[model samples]
Target: MESVGITIRLFGAFRKFGNGSEIEISVRCGTNLKELRVLLSQYLRENDPKFSETLVVDSAIANDTKILTNDFCIEKSCTLAILPPVCGG
Candidate 1:
């Protein structure tokens, strides 16, 4: 299987779901962001339930200005920003 490197950066409350900083995950080339979430849940479930829930509900995995790969294919060496819903002004 062709593989690509993905760096997931979690912000705000979502950060608690990960091991701090960024996580480098290997994904099959053409994997979608939704698929990426499933992969993350496998790892995040061990640490925080809230992270999994938030990832399902509030986060959007995007590539720069365009929100490609929400269900589209992911490219090699792409960076997905895990943005959770923000509260407060």
Candidate 2:
């Protein structure tokens, strides 16, 4: 079976998703950003429900930029950065 690896960088309130700094997650080749978000949500929910609740409450995934699968193809490397909504005066 083929595997895909990605380094997810969490920013702002989203940093609570994983321990310490960034998180490295492995997914099957061909996984899209939407799927990745779901997987990430599961990991966060297991590790910290407070972060998970925040993610859900704030609709974090919905606001994320679409991340293409490497070359926009399945079976390729990809990176994702999660950030919370920002507002300015």
Candidate 1 structure quality by residue, lDDT tens digits, 36-86: 778877767766654446555567776667555467778678787777666
Pairs that collide in candidate 1 are none
The residue pairs found clashing in candidate 2 are 30-75
Top lDDT prediction, candidate number: 1
* Candidate 2 colliding pairs, count: 1
What TM-score against the true fold does each predicted structure earn? Answer: 0.76, 0.66
For every model shown, the clashing-pair count is: 0, 1
Score residue 64 of candidate 1 by CA lDDT: 63
How do the residues 1-89 of candidate 2 rate in per-residue lDDT, one tens digit apiece?
A: 68888777777776655665578889888776566667777888788656554563343432236633423433676555665576658
The numbered model that scores best in TM-score is 1
Q: Which residue window of length 10 is worst by lDDT in model 1?
A: 49-58
